[model samples]
Target: MKDYTIHRGVDYRVYESEPTTFYAKCTQYGAGCDWLIRVTKMSRKFCWEIRKYNGSHTCTRATISQDHSKLDSNTVAEAIKPLVEVDPSIRVKSVIAKVQAKFNYTISYRKAWLAKQKAVESIFSGDDLVPNIRVLHRVFWSYYPCIRAFRHCKPIVQVDGTHLYGKYKGCLLVAVSQDGNNNIVLIAFAIVEGETSEAWHFFLSNLRQHVVTRDGVGLISDRHDSIRAAIARSNGAWSPPRAFHMFCIRHIESNFLRKFKAPYLQKLIVNIGYSRTVREYETRYQRLRERVEANTNWLDRILREQYALAFDGGYRWGYMTTNLVECINSVLKGARNLPVTALVKATFYRLNELFTRKRAEAEARINAGHVFSELVTSKLHANQRAAGNIQVSCFD
Candidate 1:
């Protein structure tokens, strides 16, 4: 019997029992030869056939051929030479072209070029991110930072939801954080069918599972009714462990605007956001109410009812804003119209690109020995220090 090697650029092992079956195996390209091949004779005139010890199918007899010669390792190697050099990239490009041709009539060349460019840019960005397993793991860690088991540290969680458009048209809930330097960091994300209380609950539950501590960590989100309901459901001695939840004031003001349309009241409500005390808020609210009454009593009622609901201290989370989620939503805008798999892949690619840019910026800053805060201050104030008599702290 004689043995032959099967090669298709990728490594593969092949064996045959007899010369005839070996010839058939070579002819079928290993497609029909599943069992080991055993060589019986390798004399001046080699003769061979194949048999399956495990009862696997044998190669077709008609596919076999014979050439009288001594079969050796060299002969088998020679037989496999041409098959090893097939270029996989050429085959891949051919397949891509064929697929593209099908849509050629519907899409213009310029549009096709743009699509290909977008796909490549999305995949090869500097973020050390890829569409496969690596990026998947990165995404998991980004939005779920609590996965890292720090011995004793407060978990910072920021939650917000955004709408996505596509075949499934839904909302994506994202949780993120801020580093000591105040840079936004992603934590975890969930794609839900809708922004209902049930959806928010499911997202929060899944998010909770990824974190180490829930007690001291703070969970921040917009003042959405669904979110409030989810938090309410989380109450009780038997409740899922609670994170000190806070609501973003921006969402509250937007809700107020939607309910109360009086222009003067709208201005007053904006002022309430800048108020330092409850007295200031009440004073502004009354003035706004009187102004609304002068125009229309019905508007006053609507504004008062909405203000009562929004200002309930239970819902406000300091001056926390929804900008982080909004940033992510903007990054996802283009890819939201894709299929689920495509959407996931595109998001990772885009995020990787973002982090890659961030890493580069950080490296550049380090290389220049430039403190980021100083740079920010210089850029904002053109390097002019505030008057000594009236020192200004930016945070204030």
Candidate 2:
């Protein structure tokens, strides 16, 4: 009836709107137009049936307004869905123009804006917003293939959070891993209100419950207090036999630089954390100590097992930093500028591209009669050549 009234350019006024009856009549009820309709629900059929119908509208419009009550926000929302899907950032003015073009009527700024909001929500499913948020429903996601690939890869996971840059607010948290061939696989993701402890707790809980299931997994990240607090509340899910938490050396270097304002000692700071043995660690520590004892107090606050490779029980896998997760952030840099739903879709397609290309390359190598990945095959051949130079001594 709303569509019919809008199309026919007729005015209507409802006298009775009830569950059992609907009565509408021409707005010029007494002048000359006798157009009216009364519909009632048949109790037996439970369906609407027209009980009375008068003659066609015999009156024309007295005045035309800039808006139509029949063309409300919900109606306009359905009309502009295609436009919203193509460009979520389309302006409110564009929405008004679209309504003018399609409906032949101009809508108010508030109505056009409301229509666009509805279109975006219907298309993208909306996002969990952050700034000045009162109620939050967090969404944490992990692709199935990526989660399934974790057991086949090395027991290491690097996690990080990057800030979104466009119309949407909040931080994008990602948990990434690598296969034997050093292919970066993004396993899990979430959007949260900055790097708060509660947010990290939500992300990590979903990651552990669904993706990071294997034992002795190495969890690498910066020493953010929120991350530490979240770990402390994990009930040993991220500790000891289950997993080991380690700090990134790059962040340590940045912290040291920030505190002491010394660039010359940054290399030494990295080398100390990169050291694979006690002697190497001591050598690097002494070198830093000799060069500058000036205001470098974070050195005294170091943890060997968390940052130093010499004491990390081989779980670091020779990785001294969260550079891998930073690389993932770089890959998603452009996506950060998109709306929340588009950003998530971008990640899905991005991971699909990576997986598709890598799978093809791996299959090609195997079909060419290689039993291992290119990295493993290269190491095996290098080992074979080195074995000819070895001389065994049998003195027993």
Candidate 3:
């Protein structure tokens, strides 16, 4: 292979392969070059046959190295991307070892790191991020189409934050919603120094302007002091008559678990948060306070309207936890350890794949004449079965 391409000023990469067959193409393939060749060797004979060949190049004679001694960062990125996607903690030394094993040539550790960095850059270079003075403070978001899709989703949105685990120190803030069929719908994301009041304000301000345009939207989150202050400072944009802010029942329960260390208080506090009526909430709240005085003191420190479902007046839709956003966070856990650009790219590609798969599923279901999603259909079936067992009396 080296002797054949050395005189032609061109390089070839393996295009197709079998036990005794090899097909290759010119390295400058997209640069107006049509040169290609195919070779096959019979098992019985020691000779190879030229099955196909495209004679001579219309493009400039390949002037670069033709021996494949040096590999570009892009090539290295493609080779290691699967590894990175599967395990972001994969070491640079491991990448070099793999490349050496595959190509029989060693790459420097710095080159390997550069290859990973380039791969990440390729993923996120498509989006426009908010300009900033500090390299670590940059914030990025989703495209306009994704932002516009929120109009069709539920009028409720959930916001949450998780820590980044790579070289850069920051937190990932995400705004997500639920579709009519209860699927998690991602709206936007941002990377900030931490979950501070200023960071929350910056993230919320951008989210309000670009994504959460609809009115009467309900927002749910944990009772973080910075988040509370940020919502308050939104100047009515996130307040009543415009949007409602609520707290996650699970977060409150976890905090209560830590503070009071009572295993039994968990259920009562959750019941209070999920109570459908003021009377039921009052009953549960009193029981909780009676069981532990510290629980009452803690409950008093939080806003009743922010957590009590009865006070929320049907805004929560029975979602008393931030599990939707937490699920998304878990899905992105593997990507959290990558560089900033790669982290953003991982999300973009994952979401793209998600949207594509879901759209195809919906189309298939519609083609089958389904009236609602499988979730809704299952609920309907259950209700129909229960209705058959109920007896009705005729009025005189």
Q: Could you tell me every candidate's TM-score relative to the true structure?
A: 0.48, 0.61, 0.64
- Cα lDDT tens digits, model 2, 243-332, are 999999999989899988889878888888989999998888877878776633557776689999999999999988998899989878
Worst 10 residues of 2 by lDDT: 387-396
lDDT of 3 by residue, 1-396 (tens): 653453444566778888788998877777788878899997678888988989876666534432243376667887787777655546778888877776655777778888876655554443445567355565858766578678889889899999998667789999899888887889999998899999999999999988998788899999899999999899989999889899998899988899888887788888888887889988888888787677898888888877887888677777788889998998888678777777776778777887889889989978666645666889989998777556332221
Please name the candidate that would achieve the greatest lDDT relative to the true structure.
Answer: 2
Of models 1 and 3, which has the larger lDDT?
3
Regions more than 4 Å wrong, model 1: 1-157, 212-214, 236-242, 292-320, 356-396
Of the pair 2 and 3, which is ahead by TM-score? 3
Query: Candidate 1 vs candidate 2: which has greater lDDT?
Result: 2
Give the lDDT of residue 72 in candidate 2.
90
lDDT of each: 0.50, 0.85, 0.80
- Least well predicted 10-residue stretch by lDDT in candidate 3: 61-70
> By TM-score, highest first, what's the ranking?
3, 2, 1
- The pairs that clash in candidate 2 are none
Over 4 Å off, model 2: 1-122, 125-136, 291-297, 370-396
